[model samples]
Target: MMEISSAFASGFQGFQRASDAVTEATVNINQQAAQSSNQRALETPVESRTGPSMEQSLVTLGSEQINAEANLKSVKTADEMLGSIIDLRV
Candidate 1:
């Protein structure tokens, strides 16, 4: 009977050790997961919201392009007129 009791005590100790090991492993895994989540949050950029509307930006760009094209046409017309005047003089 004494030997049986000793064996039971040893078995209980082994079980307790296994439980403690499982608890330690769980804690380590939770810590690693939390750290990885924090690292990812820090590495990513926050969403941007403040900027010009897409339509408005496109309209401004189109206006500038039209103004530039008109200026180029006027310069070409002036150059042709000057060339014609030079030809007449010649």
Candidate 2:
């Protein structure tokens, strides 16, 4: 029984770590995408009128922000759940 509980705790901890890694990767990807879009807009010829518009970029940024927030919330919730489980065990 003790070994089982220990294994469960380790599993939860591993899950939490994985969640953190995923969240970090997501945020990095979003930042890179925004940067790439902005860079393209700047590099494009003004007369050509090509590349992502400011409005579109803003919308994308907003969505990415929301996504990052959601991921953060997930991490927090997972931490809370792990804590609750430990409390119950004790």
Candidate 3:
């Protein structure tokens, strides 16, 4: 039971990390968008493109969303497992 609780704690930490990554990605996407717009206004050539491409940013955001959802599922599963164990012991 101690081990199970530890595992769930670890899982929760992982979820927290994933949530941080999502936040970082969102900030990066916003920065990239601003940079791209500025570059466009300057009529910069495509060869001089900087930061992540719009498509790449969108893909990253999508993947992060999936990861967050998976993490949430894991946390829920862990909670249910713990509950079951407690009920069995009782």
What order do you get sorting by lDDT, best first? 3, 2, 1
Query: In model 1, what lDDT does residue 60 have?
Result: 47
lDDT of each: 0.53, 0.59, 0.78
Q: For model 1, what is the alpha-carbon lDDT of residue 62?
A: 58
**Greater-lDDT candidate between 1 and 2:** 2
Stretches of candidate 1 exceeding 4 Å from the true structure: 44-90
Per-residue CA lDDT of model 3 for 8-85, tens digit only, reads 787788778778877777877888777778879999864544666667777877887788788778778888889999
Q: What shift in Å separates residue 54 of candidate 3 from its native position after superposition?
A: 2.6
Count of steric clashes across candidates, in order: 0, 0, 0
Quote each prediction's TM-score.
0.46, 0.48, 0.75
lDDT of 2: 0.59
Off by over 4 Å in 3: 42-50
Residue pairs with backbone atoms closer than 3 Å in model 1 (clashes): none
- By TM-score, the candidates rank as 3, 2, 1
